[model samples]
Target: MRYIAIDVGSTFLKAAQLDVQYLAITNMESIRMPEPLPNENPLVKEWNAIQLLELMQGLIDRQLASCPGCKGIWISTQMHGFIITDEYGVAVTPYISWQDERGLEYADKLGSSYFSALMERVGEEAWRRTGLWEKPGVAAVGLFHMLQQADSGMEIEWEGQGTACPVSMNDIQTLGSKRLCTLGGYLIQSLTGSHVCHFTNAAPTGLVDVRAGEWDIDIVRAVGCQALQFPRIVVGTDIVGHYHSRWGAIPVYPDIGDHQASVLGSLADATNEAIVNMGTAGWISRVSDAYHIGEWELRPYFEGSYLPTITKLPGGRNMAVLVRFIADVGQSIYGTALTEDTLWERLLAEADRAAQYFKTGKGQSSNGQLHVHVGFYGKQTVADKGAIDNIDSDNLQVGGLFAAAMEEIAAIYERNLYVLATAGEAIEQITFTGGVIMKNAFLRDAIAKAVGIEAVMAPACDEVFHGLLRLALVSEGLYASVHETREVLLQAIL
Candidate 1:
């Protein structure tokens, strides 16, 4: 069987074709978005979504035309990129990336009690957890929690759009201007043709009933939308649908955001097992048999079959941030796209960019490197409120400061891993995936030393995609369970 995996990450988007039976990649390519699009451009927003969807279909046609339709085409995308849309699936608002900090007000509304309760059950989301603690680049898991608080009557207000938009984590959805439907479930619909959240997707939405493993009405109202409209939850392995015929009519398998899928694909979502995937971005997650809520956070996710709660580390886009800062040091002699990469040739080119960036910033060495923090998942912030500026040259330094900043990032990972390992109370090996592992030797060595665990890379970079195929084989009943699928994968690929 062949599986086409599309990874829609916070940074670059990628598509791949894998031969599950042979454990081979017949084809793979990174989906490219035209650069220089402004934040609020409607054309940029709507067209990007639609065009990318089409391109994904096209890739399937190109790669699998000879093999007939694939068993499943999986989408492992970024989570909480809350984009509103009309009935036809046209985007109503620009895509709000996982990095956006615009929802801090919602964090304030979550109230001490709710957050306290959540902490006792699960950890807080990354958007603000590190501010109280001071970590960088971690994902903001609290976004869902905060959004929920804003929607509920237990309301509080903070400055937003001049006055405030109401503290409602009940992420609203509309079927055109009719306002006939609304819910946290619209996120996946806006991206794929599907109009539902996956089983794992719901857990992180701060809307799933942790105990019941089902959607919660109260939580749905909190995001300010009806729960019914969201995509119906399905196991990560279930067959969702087939790609529209325009692209190639491949089968579509919607899923838990990329993070959870990575945990499974890497075989890290297991008792005392873990993995850190450092791609164009980075993240950390642990798989337990059941959910455990620690004192400082709420249970972010609870799969019926697994208890895999994750924290987005601060390493992903920061690589690009550093790469640009490095480039700004001098004239990029060759226009080679070396912001971040591991391809032998690409790395050498990026090195030249870094060299130039370093030389130019020598005098302004005090420009000082910036540290990106994480809370498993991070939404980084600084101690001082007014001490911030846009992430251009002023805020992101690259000299002696850069070295200092890298040290801080390394420390943040090591320290947080210690806290989480202790907080969760049981853990062992930490695995790694994504692009960063092969790209940055220094980072790999540093992380290995910091966590005090031997890190293993996915034998194949396309593990996530092939892993999807494994899930399809199970969900489609070709095999009885993940273990059986694993046995075949090990025999064929490993």
Candidate 2:
């Protein structure tokens, strides 16, 4: 059997043709996500809903053409972003991105940000029900921002219209009639007329009672979006609807969260191994058979399991700061425009050389003399800026600098892993995935050494696709359960 797997990622849109019987991805394709629509508020990031849908349709159509007789369509999407749709299932607003930060804007006379106000109203208990932290860019916060604007009689500018009309009070009153759809849910609705959300995807919305497996009405009311419509929550393998395509009607599954999909695809031993995925952003996660909440973020996983995760760590985005600095210096001082690939190659090569030099007891013995904190984008508690400490003349080279940065990131993983360990979820090994860790062998080794454990790369770079493929197989009844499918596939691949 064959299936089409799609990933609506934050930076890119990807699709693949999966041969379930052979456990192979016969073909895969990706395209950069469309540029966000211009907004007056720089913090507000959004995309044209219809345009994004059309782009995805083109990508899926190409995949279907290349691989005929596709039996099903499975999807995984970036979490915490959504669009508001009218009663007829047509989008009324832009597709607000997960990167959107309008929720941080001041919402009222009390000098409270939309996010802060919503957090205060929801309180700790209601917040805990969603298994999420109080943060901006989440769907609930975004909805609250809209609600506050409507309540204040303030016009919410989208796509940069100066004299935009204020969102009417009636719009707020009629919110229950409107549908809140994530990108994946919107796609499913557009393709198969299904209005459903998978638990994995829904958990990040800050509106669901994750343990209860439903939207929390109290939390919804607290956010002043009690009238807003939410989709039906489904489990991992539920078939939401069928997409009628040129090939035929293909079984369509509700989109799961990309993070969950990537971890699932890694084929890590859920009981004894954790997965560290470092892409544009990074996270260290371990699977659990039951729900347990603590300092770490809790997300719903397949087969009623849970994932204890430390998310939003520094990754490629942080690494890019140094890379861009080097590139800028080269262009400004030497008038040389370095290609991105060349820059990365040189950086990694230098980092590798530095590692080898240190291992062999180099001349200066400047080990631990330099440190790079990779928190360019603030961490969970404070908006701490990135810093470099203990830099000396002997260790102030590109190789040393990059190596220190890699070591710092590895240390972060180790520290967070200890958090999981303290919570009684210790792992003996790690399955690493994502572009950053996969491309840099030195970084992977650094992580392994830092964590004091064996580390292995995922069998495939496109872990989300593999994860969706596994889910598809289970949905088709080829596998008795996700756990069984993972064991069988892991053995086959290894």
Give each model a TM-score. 0.67, 0.94
In TM-score terms, candidate 1 sits at 0.67
Encode model 2's per-residue lDDT on 294-313: one tens digit a residue: 98888999888888888877
lDDT of 1 by residue, 322-404 (tens): 45655554346655443333433453344444435655875233534444432222343211111222244553533333443
In terms of lDDT, the best-performing candidate is 2
Alpha carbon deviation, residue 94, candidate 2 (Å) = 1.7
